[model samples]
Target: RGMNAYERLTSYWPSYDSISPEARRAYLQWLSSGRKAPHANIGYVFLFFYGLERRVFVDAKTDQAAAGDIPIIIAEVERLLSIYGKNNSFNNYASRFVDFLRQGQILARRYQKAPPAPLPYGYEMPVELRIGLGQLAADKQPMPADWALAWVLSDHNVGKRTPVTRCKEAFAQLFCMRYEERYGAGMVLPQNKTRLRLQYNTASAGLPPQELDGLSGIPDVTATSAARKKLQQLVDECTVQLEPYSRYLGRNPDTPDALEGLLQLPVNLWPPTARTALAELKQRIGDGMVVMSFGELAGRLQSAGSLSREKVLTLARALESLHIGIEPDVLTGSRTPKSEDNVALFATQADDGDLRSSPAYSAASVTLDLACAVAAADGDTSPQEIMLLSQHIDSWSHLSGAHRKRLKAHLRLQLNQPPTLQSLKMKLEPLAEPAKRVVAAFLAHLAQVDGEVSPAEVKLLERVYKTLQLDPQSLYSDLHVASSGSSVGSSQTTPSIPGASPSKPVGGFALDQERIAQLQRETEQVSALLAQVFVDDKPAEPDDVVVEETVEDTSSICGLDADHSAFLRVLVSRTEWSHDELEAVASDMELMLDGALEQINDMAFEHFDMPVTEGEDPFEVNPDIMDKLPL
Candidate 1:
């Protein structure tokens, strides 16, 4: 009578009777104390967890009333793990027990007809795994980095699906990235398997193995208000542009020649003359090149009657950018086409000068002209300069072959008889404001391409600047860009270019050239910033810049509006920031983080010669930049 059935089990060597009287009393005290948390012994924690496993598995299996306790059991397990999870074995068993309650409980023999508790509280399926199990891409989670994490979670054989067999993890990431691009994120595939094979150390509980449903819906990432606003703007813009052509979209946006595809569908909306030219070009595209000679192209263009040079160039260039070759020299006896010849799209008369109607082409063509002029300033144009000119012409896809040929001829003419620099005011008149800065910036960069701006090249740059109505000092900044490797700043405020500057005054003990002094100032500013970050000492400010953080209005700093100004303030305070840290702050500030860094640096270029922030991942403030208010 002294020992009941429970007492008999407790008296077993591995049970409560195995512990000392003092230890047994401590365990009983903990049990009576409501099992709150911060338990003392791992054995005591496991001893208690064993009973929970039995109640959930054994009792719930045969009794419907017992099955109702599954959720409560899961929550209790979650709570205990929160406290004593430091024990590795206990952590593993407790976590698996909870996983069973949430997903595997449905597999029990008694619960097979219907799971009393389906997906217990606080449990979620991973999006990638759900997708692998056959979730629709449109319905599945939006994972920008799905490839990085998805395939590993899938736990399936994909050897037959891909050519890659090794480094599966890396290949999975690459495959998934491409998968997202082609099919759009995730394709809702049919569940690869309806049943999951969950393996864990549940045998100790004396419970039989059971099957559970593996299919689970993934929770989608909620779109932030800012994201929704951008989506709305894009939808509105697309609606305006596509509404008229929606009916003509015989296929998806994957169609390269949408216009030709539409025109083939028996449409009569196009003008007869426009249709004829389009048909001929389409045939030329099928033939792999535009076979007409320069004179023939001119004849065809003139036959258009009222078509302007701007319209002719724009239409022809747009067609060529699509990889449709317009080889005006194919029939010419030379056989080989001139590479990057800025030839006209439709033929032009000799009197019809350089095509300037297209603003984009005007800016690019002028930049090339100024580049050649600057290269020849020293009266010795090397192959490198000429090569650079040709490379640019090849990359300018928006210019027609005829127009590009013209540009190429201009380069040749310069090499044979170097053209002298002249006022570019009239050439720049039709160009946009941003294009104007490009004209002067390109000249400075070209002069500094050889690593040093010569006196002759410097004078030519100055003249180009005056002609473009830009500041002459910016010439040095542009040269500095080539010397330092920074990008061109915006038109609003001329920051400078990137690249190597001429070697500094070597000794640097006394006053030197203004450019050398500028370099010294930048070096000193970098030192001041280092002192602030590492030594926590305030560096003496330049006399020209005196900032009072407390007195300043955050809404506007260095001509930036409220949003950007605040973003810059955070960057100014820290020297280095991780990509994630910057993204978090940008998201919190409601600013698009993708190009936010560039925009801030572009504006910073105006005030300082250096970029405020640079680098993509581990984005950091330029250590060499001035330690002033970089607004």
Candidate 2:
């Protein structure tokens, strides 16, 4: 009555209480007597339970036991298990062990998916990766190392594309965009994607298009008030000269070959002696080779027309710079057909001793010369302008050593090319239509040198525009909006060139103190911004600098020898010193101080050589305190 159902299950004698006295005695007998009765199913279950309960053997104890002994041991375990039944047997142990192993596996998977902590909020991420080893080995010059970093951020595959093709595409896009940014979109005449693809294909094949009308345009680089004023002046001057020339030519009605008056003007002016010298040189060197010589070339032009030696020399320099095959010889024989044809485009002679004009000229040289003249007129040259000029010069068709030398000399002298048809046409080209406008705008400022554009200067401008493969009028817009302070082909808002002074005029104009100060502030801000972008901005050290200094001991000390100090100095100087010049010097002093401290320690410690008794130890407390104390 006192024990409930739970208590009955917990109690050990539940069977003895419920069953008959005989059954209870039998259960007690079964527990006390361990007997082996071999039945196949019982024996199998008992042996399986025994094997399941076996501990992992560390030694060879189980291997030597008899086979019959194993069955007997299993039977004895089963007899004990029969009393306990299924509840307290091998099943409980197996279930608990399985549960523990399964729980561990679950934990291993859960920890694997957790995200790492984000970097601190203020830290800047590095933008560039190290260039590949292959690229470094193959590189001939120090390529702009920063270019790769800038490139990756602005133009790389975000997801699907490969890095190489993406880089190339990005670069192409940037090149075109840069042009549009500096010049107007109209300047390039960019069409639809299909048209651009076709154009790109044609360019790739080296097959240039037939003559098209260029979009007349000015660049954002010329957005300043000074630049506008200069451009207006150029337009006015060119209009004055060209308007008259176009009228005159329209009235004359002369055939291309039969301009009798024109022929006589140049022929009568030729110097026979120089012409003869040129003819001899041309014969000896062949027209191809003689065309490269400036002296011979100048004489050839004199033979063609009434050019002064100086004017002839100027033309010769321009022509040779273009790499055209022409000689001043009057003789017609031995001139190969190819040479004859090439010279015909640059020819100024009809039959003999006559000025015959051709359609071609050195457009690039003339344009550069005009720009240089404008820059010189500015009074103070800027680094931006100088860099642009350098880039412009680099784009020209490569010339020979002698020709380049002469051309540079001419530029240095600030000499103008004459206003002949050939010289004028040489100032223009189809591919560089926007460049022509740049040159023309600059030419306006050039007249500022003397205060006005002359008839000769106007004529030079007209001839240059006329020579371009594309029609120049198409590119230079007729819209002259004086109030808007802009023209048709120019951008409404002009962007300044990088590293250029935005406040200063793009055209050659003087700035006041206020403007100069503004430019300085802007430049400083830009420098700071650039510093933030760069990873390593340290100034390079001089290659031949002494990074370390040796300090000699010239002091008298207690028992320290001169040789020991000298040895210490050598040891200090020999250690690697990697720091700025000032810091390195300080570091060397600290190292020398450290050595002196060590020397002092040695003199007090090991060098003193104090004798010690066998039983004595320095750190032990004295046990003779009782002896020292008063009794």
| Per-residue alpha-carbon lDDT of candidate 2 for residues 1-631, written as tens digits (9 for 90 to 100) | 1211111121221222454444444434433344322222222232333342342111123555543344454444445344333442222222222221122112211212322121111111111111111122223222222322222222111111221122233333333344334444212111111110000001111222221112112111111122223223332333332332233233444521222212222222223553354456445544223223343333344433344333333334333333332333112111222212222213222222222111111233444455554454334444544444443343333333332323343343332222244443422333344544443433332222222333444344344445544343432221121112232234323332212222335665443434233323322322232223223322342232222222222221235553333222222211122223213222333334334445734653453342111121121112222112111
TM-score of 1: 0.28
Q: Candidate 1: which stretches are off by over 4 Å?
A: 1-14, 34-36, 104-151, 154-176, 181-200, 203-631
Backbone clashes for every candidate come to: 33, 16
Q: Each prediction's TM-score against the native?
A: 0.28, 0.17
Displacement of residue 282 (Cα, Å) in model 1 is 30
Q: What's the C-alpha lDDT at position 503 in model 1?
A: 53
Scored by lDDT, the top model is 1
TM-score of 2: 0.17
